[model samples]
Target: MLLLSLFVQPATKTQAATDLGLTVDAAILIDASTGKILYEQNGYESLGVASMSKMITEYILLDAIKAGDISWDQKYQVTDYTYAISQKRALSNVPLREDGSYTIRELYEAMAIYSANAATVAIAETIAGSEKAFLELMGKKVESLGITDYTFVNSTGLNNKDLQGYHPEGTAEDGENMMSAASIALIAYHLLKEHPDVLDTAKVTEKTFREGTSDAIVMKNWNFMLPGLIYEYEGVDGLKTGTTDFAGHSFTGTAVRNDQRLIAVVMKAVDANGEGSYKARFDATKKLFDYGFTQFSEQEVLPAGFVVEGNESIDVIKGKADTVNIATAEAISLMTTKDDVAKFTPTLFLDEEALEAGVEKGTVVGKIVLEHAEGKDYGFIEGGDLTVDVVTTENVERAGGISLFFAGVGSFFKNLWGGVTDFVGGIF
Candidate 1:
């Protein structure tokens, strides 16, 4: 739960050039814990997203399974519609037989690992009765997440040209699934955050689907960042990839190192000849992850029960104790760079008035204003400022009636004597 507390202040946006020089149409790198965007280029420009849409499809299926709406062991029979799409030579698929029945788990593994179009369709048809209906559900889910710019035409992310007559009634014939790099990153973040168990499926480099049967199919993950792949990257884990005539080579990759996880998305990475470059997307993704781990690190900024240096005590009027000590409510942490560490500063602000008698402990009294001096490279702090609540450390009870009377009399004489002494000194 590495989220900042409400009282903690956010650091100011200090722009620094993250000059990675990537060769892609759109890209983004984000801290999975805080949802902070570390680097981005054309992240919001919409383009065809190809099979990356299957990640969303997986999300819908996983959620359905979790809610008891569907079960892994439940089996579905392949239909003519599914088989027809599977036979398309341009699309990636696990061949399904018209007479074969597959379990929800089998189809899901095929769809997730092999990016199989037919298996995706079979699962969609089983759950929603049609890919169109499943797409409608996807649209609603995307809308609920506050992502506005995107469209889903089919479940497998195959171009409408290849799926011309297979679409359900009332679906647009010209539609192709399109998404921005930011939207894709957001979807990946939500997917990993909510259903981390999906990683178990994504982490498999190779496995046998429909094992020990005559129709047994072998599946190998296409994500090159995995451990045994040629472009093996340390800490890289489950995600999805896409390529098409329109979408080019795209990927949504996630990795974890030292307990910090990051998600990187690269879309439309191409070669000098304007062809989808398989190596370019993987290269760009690796660079992004490298930059994130090298430049930034998470730091704990404030500890719970921390007392403000100068404003630790507040006077308690007519109370059992003369004053009460105050401290912070919770600890806070932020991802920071080396330059930010040098300029870090914390300022404390206290309430102007004293606390009244009968005040209770844990009452809000002031706040801690955490800041950093502006560096020469940037006029503002790289991470935004943070503020945390200051609370009373102890209760203060009201004085008894007899004690209050004596205290009032002693206060009156002290003031009167001070006034007389001032007059006598002036006369002399």
Candidate 2:
């Protein structure tokens, strides 16, 4: 019986979000380097972002600095507009004096650690001429990131201006500044990916602004997950935290273990009495990091040149040689549980068409995937993915399409003629 072969492309792994025992309104855990979703709950659920909005603002500011548009040491004079916004009194103010000034670096630290509303506005004004125009830049950044749910109203999230009778229309407060745990995590990841040095300031547990400049203001990170916590978790780095009567408490955090870095975000978590919101986010994030690091280990399955199928040589058509040796494409590794190691199955991905008469040596033809037991004890145990490439013993010139077509037609006619001759011979 003749066997028909079909060539199919390699399959991409589908990520599944797992539920953790998190009471936070929304949360997600992700692998920083790979953008792999390890676990998520209400990951796409949007909520008021509060000062977490500053992350996007900080990102834009960093980009401008990196592009030479502004330098950290460059002084930004505090104009009346910046000073007036700082005096809102409803927001977290770093208290910029109308006559005093600060450098880009100072504003960066204030926005990142203290979550100072005034510092955010001053930075925005210095960079984009007005906070409104700066927010327009923020929207563009969100759009480029593929974040669909978030909107920006002002440099600092002090609610709409109408709350203070400044602008009644602004009082209606657009929900333009909403975001989900997933989007926050992605933004944090990109920020770290591009400029890892930002973490240096964010991780600071305590610092003070220019001493005499603003009544000797002491600044401390509101994020409880930073180092110096009672938990003493290793490799935990500071990110950001936010809380408003409307937005609740939100936090983004990063942790590293054994060379693996993970980012976790929690949003809209509230205390039973509507306080201690930051503590809730801290607890949830610590739980996620602990759970991820404790359970899974990376396993290597197929090493390069490992024999997949053996004892029989596959045919190579119209080559300098009749056959060739085929090997696994690359080494394969998977993150899995201890039990999965014993029962893992590796599937070979190959295109049989490439094994035809004229084939190129060392062309990637397929992939190897290890499937693990699904659910509970072994849930999400992927045996790790692998690739397979063909190593031909001899090179063959590729046949032209026109020549191959004519040759195929001629071969069909010749076979027909031979069948007729064989029938005639039998009759005779």
Candidate 3:
């Protein structure tokens, strides 16, 4: 334990800059294994997400490739709008030739590794034929992922004003796409779980667009926390970095050590001087990662087939048996500290219809809602199952007709006798 604490210590040596707490607009730390948040401050407040928006574009592109809707080698045609954006040295871009052709693989590498703005637009064009249409697709995608706190105005995350007059219509001219820090963390968490291979490209420190060619350009990854870069932290690989006049410096960072992976987000980080810079964001992320690894560890919080004492079973209606046993559908574990192990509470819920009907073993009759006081459980982006499912442990059959008839007769006579006894007692 002491060794792990030593190894996972914050990489940033300066305390004066970060001791006043995280100097960011918002921040979050999450355990990727369980969609549970470890810490957050203003995480739910919507703010400019900047280039971190490209993570969605990257996800759709990767999904398209995986589904065979697009090929890595498929050539992408350059448009004048894209051509103009690519040539703008002020914005991050790899020069593209309008007269030339580039493959999906080439653009993807540039977009992922270099945060090339035009390259992202090229992918959007290929997938949905226009940036507005691509925004619709992005809308549908985020909806399916259960993301609600977001407003994406453009594909490249560039301020719409930077797109000149060529910007997609129906969006504000000066608006920047916005999302909460928690929302970005959700995307990063799912990205690692669903398409882990993104790390293959995101980890690249430097890549060339076209080696020894006229359009040749050298691109360096904007994420500086990967291994050899300045502000590098151990196990840091992905996910994206964002900066703009409005968004300041934002980064979604993830790391793995001791088999536990954590995702951290720092939105608009600044130093003690209140100056937003690359180092500030990395330092902010380092604090989160350090706090996550050192203070918390993953352990089994709830086991499978668990039952609430004294409320373990429900009454069975019109079945051979009057009651049935039930237990949790599965086991659950969470990333937490030893002190928090006692804080978890699981509540059960039973389905009334299932209880009324003859049910088979393994039938899902209810669920356990696990709650804790430390943080709100985000569960997963899609949905959390059962929290844990409560299922019947044994099959129950319908009672025979003869048994029903005898039970009905017994009930009738019992009521009659009770009424007669009540009348005699009233007279006395």
Measured by TM-score, the strongest candidate is 3
Name the regions of candidate 3 deviating beyond 4 angstroms. Answer: 1-20, 212-214, 353-358, 373-386, 399-409
Model 3: lDDT equals: 0.84
For model 3 the TM-score comes to 0.87
User: Global CA lDDT of candidate 2, please?
Assistant: 0.68
TM-score of each: 0.80, 0.77, 0.87
Model 1 C-alpha lDDT per residue in residues 110-164, reported as the tens digit of each score: 8888888889889889889988798898898887677888978888887777774
Q: Candidate 2 deviates by what RMSD?
A: 5.8
**Candidate 2: misplaced stretches above 4 Å?**
1-19, 88-90, 161-176, 211-215, 230-232, 271-276, 301-317, 322-328, 332-336, 339-352, 355-361, 366-428
Error of 1 at 346 (Å): 6.0
lDDT of 3 by residue, 1-428 (tens): 00101122222211112232899999988888877777777787999999999999999998998999999999989998889999997799998987778999999999999999999999999999999899998888887778887888899889999997777888888988999988888888888888999999999999888988877899999999998998889999888999999999999999999899999999999999999999999999999999999988977778988877876677788788888888987888878789777656666666663375477889887677665533334344334532787798898888888987887798899999999999999999
Per-residue lDDT value at 350 in model 2 = 54
Question: Alpha-carbon error at 225 in model 2, in Å?
Answer: 2.0
Q: Candidate 2, residue 121: CA error in Å?
A: 2.1
Which should have the higher TM-score, number 1 or number 3? 3
TM-score of candidate 2 relative to the true fold:
0.77
